[model samples]
Target chain A: MAEAGAPIIEAIGLTKTFKVAQKPPGFAASVRHFFKRTYKEIPAVTDVSFTIRPGEMVGFLGANGAGKTTTLKMLTGLLHPTAGRCVVDGREPFARTRDFLSAITLVMGNKQQLLWDLPARDTLRLNAAIYGISDADYKSRVDELSGMLELTDKLDQPVRKLSLGERMKAELLASLLHGPKVLFLDEPTLGLDVNAQVAVRAFLRRYNERTGATILMTSHYMADITALCSRVLVIHEGKLVHDGELAALLRRFGTRRELRVELSHAVDDAKLRTLGEVLSHEGNVARLAVEPAALVAVVGRALAELPVVDLTVHDPPIEEVVGRVIGKSQRALPNVVGAEQGA
Target chain B: MNAALRKMGGLLSVYYAYMTAYRAELILWALANSLPFILMGAWYQAAAGGAFGFTPVDVTRYFLAVFVIRQLTVVWVIWEFDQDVQRGRLSQYLLQPVDPVWRYLAAHLSERVARLPFSALIIALFFLIFPPARFVPHASDVLLAITFATLAFALRFVMQYTLALFALWTERASSLESLMFILYLVLSGAIAPLEVFPPELRELVMWTPFPYFIWVPARLLIGGADVDLMRATVVCVSWIGSLLVVNRVVWRLGLKRHSSMGA
Candidate 1:
């Protein structure tokens, strides 16, 4: 009936529905609706349940309005589920008790906790005081995080003056100053340059390795999930469609690989079809699709029969595979997974 | 409690720094409070030969006290509250371990602290114009009035903040605030002293929280009256306790709506 060590974050039959008014498009209709409005129940998250063991890094995946944000907000205690319940670290999230709050941190890429007009150090100090961190501990944590983020020189500048990357780093420092045991990140890498995204991804990986904090992150950026999370929970139209290791999901749907070969001489398209389905042929160069099991055989034949000068293989575009995965459920239709082509 | 105070200290320091940094906004706020000076000049001119039960000097003294008390007690917490709720800036505060109320309180208090120098400058200007003016009463009464003014500030801040929570339910809460503001301006002795009203009207106004905010403090400085002090103390304490209770109830209800309905 019970496990020896329970999950740190647990949810059961969680459902949330919002009551929205139906207002018609004319002045008279608006007036009529104002007096006696019709209502519709829009289910955001429906009967979703999952458990996250301690020290696990899990990515939450969905298209926009696919209940990714709603679920995250509920877990962070920003919203209450209309039904069922969730517990983070043995405490009900909606209760939002001080101990519970101090033990977890939520970082939103669009929203910031730093005071806009004040120096980053002041806001960090305020957080330190609110969390009741000791002076020595605050100093050490600030120094350590600032050092890791390369933000020591930027701490004294007003937040508005800092670059976007610098500001996000400062935000990370502020959120981590208390050393929370759990992290909830919503698009923590949104709208950043490639270098900044890589840096942030590296920092998050290093932080997880060092602290072993349980993290449940939702990111539109596929690279973010692929880089940091080995496990993923995919939600589509208020329902949990996939819950497993990321590699397994990729392997199942990412079976199609592209094989390209540059021959020493020209070859006809019909001959190239022997190796696999020829996608495109340009003179001596050809691109073909092959299944996983036949990849080696196809490559060997191409090398032996054709004047193959150079060859390369690639997994099917990740975006295409992910779209197919979400597309499978959506063909039954109603909740299309959020624009699942790519982040 | 120790942790709360420590946290408040940090907030106050940041707001204080903000106050010092944004001197232009502070100056603009000071200029806005100069309405009392205009009212003072008009009333003084009208009483040029001592009319409406007061001499010109008395008119100057009353308005000067009004100016200083206005500086001390006026708060913009309602505006901030409306903006926070409307724009969802409150989300940032909700995620944190600390209650966000103290941040607003510290912000308003620091504004008053920053306005102290401007109030002193206004006092100097008042003295420069009416050279034969003594604006304060007996030493004990002055101190008591200052204490009463502090409580009045707290009362007004909390009351306005409590009313502003209606923004969570309705988009037009500021209309209610503006209606209340007009009543306060007319009855709280911001525009004219309550003594000018008929005796019956004055009695009715005294029962309201308006007089404790401006008239009591203003009247105390002009004349040290024990009865006004007693009434102010009773009114200030009762309104504060009552508003605090209402604030707690409203805060809980508002948070429920916010969590369920989304900010």
Candidate 2:
């Protein structure tokens, strides 16, 4: 008999390498490749391993080319690891047995599974049949999902007619109709507005709570991680750098918090520098990076000495903390804006 | 019984929705298939009096049967497979409990059903003008024809699906399909009746599985059945069986290679 509360997914020393053909940028090089080609081994993932207990929701984080997506693909059986092994619910994902496939689902924001020309209800019926769900079960699940996602009005409409947010909601409902035990969601909220993002987040949280399904998700959105995941695994350049509590990640890399002070009068830059490291000063607004322990003292002194009108303290946005933890240079902070933003 | 029928009925309705969505493309496909009619006219005129012991009427019946068989057995697995593998759509099917082959088969059958009404109208018009025989066969011969025709369809589908598996290793699945199409066109008696071919060529065509796909069924429908034809029916069944085994093997091996390569 299986353990009642064991980890639903386990990986050991998983690695994947791709043989990328090397070709010069020219007609001559293209012709040469046609006749005789040279190839180089590009290691996309290396020696990364982790485990997830049943019902645990884990966030996967990494910069571009950091092997986050590749790792997820391996876990989901979409790709085979070049070295090492992974087991999802005691089955090898690469085998892709029908029983194994029926138990898991992968939802990609950029890739849609819903039939383009058909309505959501058609897809739902097709999936229900494919999963061998009884009619009563299928109906009840569909009804529940429709109510939760507000898809009742949109089920009969062609999927092409739905907006991106609406379409994603339908995709989610269709994918989950099978009552999968594991879900591998890759940027499930990639292009949705803030309200849509929150709705999806709320849905995911409730689903996880109610069903006790293991979820492995990767997102560039810090809000998603902060809101849904208590634990995160950070990878960089095909290597695992950190895997533990989300708070631990913050404590290790998020050593400083920004304190924005609105002064009643324009403050001298030199005086602010004496209070804390002056990050920026423009007009009566000044920004300072204060150590966590010094935040209270610094705020008190600034309020007592300077004509402060308003003040707010916040941790550096997750993007910056992640960048710093990955050993990216401070000068590269601006580039973080483009890394997995909003998703 | 009604509930079971309802499930099956619902499947067809969903298929209908897909067809209606692509109704314009269906019309274009019907137009493209008129090439066989053009060929039939050209051949009928050439055989105005007689050619190779076949009269113009015989040519008309044979070509019309050829047209119907060709349309019924039409499949484009190579293109579908290539696109799915390249674009990662195959993963979507993998995520489901249903076998991808069944879904592909359903989609293929649904498209055929959608085109049935238009095809029936064309056949009806041809019959009204020419008035060919209704082809009432002996009970045993009818059984043989139905059995062999079904096996032929299955063989053709599986063989093409197996060939499509080459997309896992090479990028020339379309070229491969073209080569198969040329072979089928020549060997399956789609362009001309096998009876018109030289004796030696006819013998060779009989030995290959290509003839069973179109020529055998069309011959059975138009030329009537023979007791000796049961031998050919057996051959068709064996071919289907072997091809099914080969299809499973190829699918398993190709999936292994694909997973390792991470396409």
Candidate 3:
């Protein structure tokens, strides 16, 4: 058993390299390729390492082909790492013991495990059996999780007939039926609408608070990370770039604060630029990128000197901060970046 | 019940539901194995001319038995496993505590259960079309046929699943099954009985696993005097055991190569 406060998930210098077939275009090249195929070794994840203590909800941030999914796959024992090692819940993940598997679950938003033609209840039951949950416990768990997810009435509908959000909720129910202590969620809300995304995010937060389960999740939607995770690990181009508090990440890359101003009358764009860098300007509304140190002064000056109806100062968007981090990492490690992008 | 048994039961019931969801498709899939009837027509005419050892009546009974065996022993694990590997669906099963093989096995079993009623209906229809094709076998022969037919399904499934493991390296592993299927067609007596083959060739083919898949079980149903039941049992068991070992080895190596594509 894993000890309390120990790192339940650990990746030490972990890496994965894929031997991708090189298929050149053109009919002539295709025929030659068919006769004698060649393969090039492309590294997907490079010497990345991180440790998450039990109950930590650490957001995994990355861009497309940035190895977030590959790292999760290796951690879940679905793929063997080409180098280094990973241990989840006190066991080598690649060994895949029943205990190890029972302790962890991986949910990919683009993939599904539910039976498309059958009701979601059937899959929940199957998962219960597979996880060794007794009949009574299974019933109670389903009732509780469904109620929390607001999916109690939808469990009986065929998965193919359900809406995408409902299907995602059902997939979540199936993945969580085992009460796994560790969750690796890759884009849990990839294509969900605002309401669905909020619902999922809220459910995850409540589940985490109640169960104290560790989570390592990746999402293209920045709101998911900002809402659920206080700490994050940022990977760019198959390498770990940042691992610390979410606030620290913002402070590091968020060099400018955003100030939105509503003027009583139209102001000259040049006048707005004198206050701060004018990010955008309309008839009577302007957005400025003010340095964090000068945010209060800029807001006061805008309120006192300009014909301002209202003004608000806010931190830079999490998306911009994260994008800047990725951009910086790409520039810093151009030579070490892997050849292949892993989504 | 224990957790393992409960898991198997759950998987079987769900897959049974899945298979029976489209009732017409089930019947169509069951009827798709009608090649034996087509070959029976050609062989039945030849037998009527006294070209083979058996009379025309014997040819009809043989092909009918072959049809039954085909229904019981048909395995499509290769295609399903290939798709799972290529589409990354296999990762779902791999992440679970149970081995993915058990899931596939349960699906195949459930599909057979869903397909049997339709198969029985088709057999009855065939009997009505040709009354001479029906026969009343001894109870012992009936039981033995069931036993050997089951063994044939097991052997065929394991063989094809072994081939399917190659999907870890190549996306088109079913091509291998297609290539091996030609040998299966010729040697399993789907086209004609082994009695039609030369004695030396028949002797050699008996050592292979293909005959047990169709010929041995079909011949057992007819109580053919040529079948050495003890030898057939030993060979079938031996092949299953050997193939299981090979399956595990290939599966281990395949896992090392698996990239969990399409995720």
Best by DockQ: 1
By DockQ, highest first, what's the ranking?
1, 3, 2
Clashing pairs in 2: A220-A343, A221-A343
Model 2 spans > 4 angstroms off: A254-319, A328-343, B1-13, B128-146, B225-227
For each candidate, the alpha-carbon lDDT, in order, equals 0.83, 0.79, 0.88
Worst 10 residues of 3 chain B by lDDT: B254-263
User: Candidate 1: deviation at residue A168, Å?
Assistant: 1.0
**Backbone clash total, candidate 1:** 1
Better of 2 and 3 by lDDT: 3
TM score of chain A per candidate = 0.79, 0.81, 0.83
TM-score of predicted structure 2: 0.86
**Model 1 off-target regions past 4 Å?**
A1-4, A254-322, A330-343, B133-137, B224-227
- lDDT of candidate 1 over A76-156, digit per residue (tens): 898999998998888888898988888898898988888889899989878887888999999999888888888899999
State the lDDT of candidate 3 residue by residue for B130-212, as single tens digits. 99888998888888889999999999999999999998878669999999999999999989899989999999999999999
Q: Candidates' DockQ values? A: 0.58, 0.36, 0.46
Measured on C-alpha atoms, candidate 1 has an lDDT of 0.83
True contacts kept of each: 0.64, 0.52, 0.67
Please give, for every candidate in the order listed, the TM-score of chain B alone compared with the true chain B: 0.94, 0.87, 0.97
Q: Which 10 consecutive residues of model 3 chain A have the lowest summed lDDT?
A: A334-343
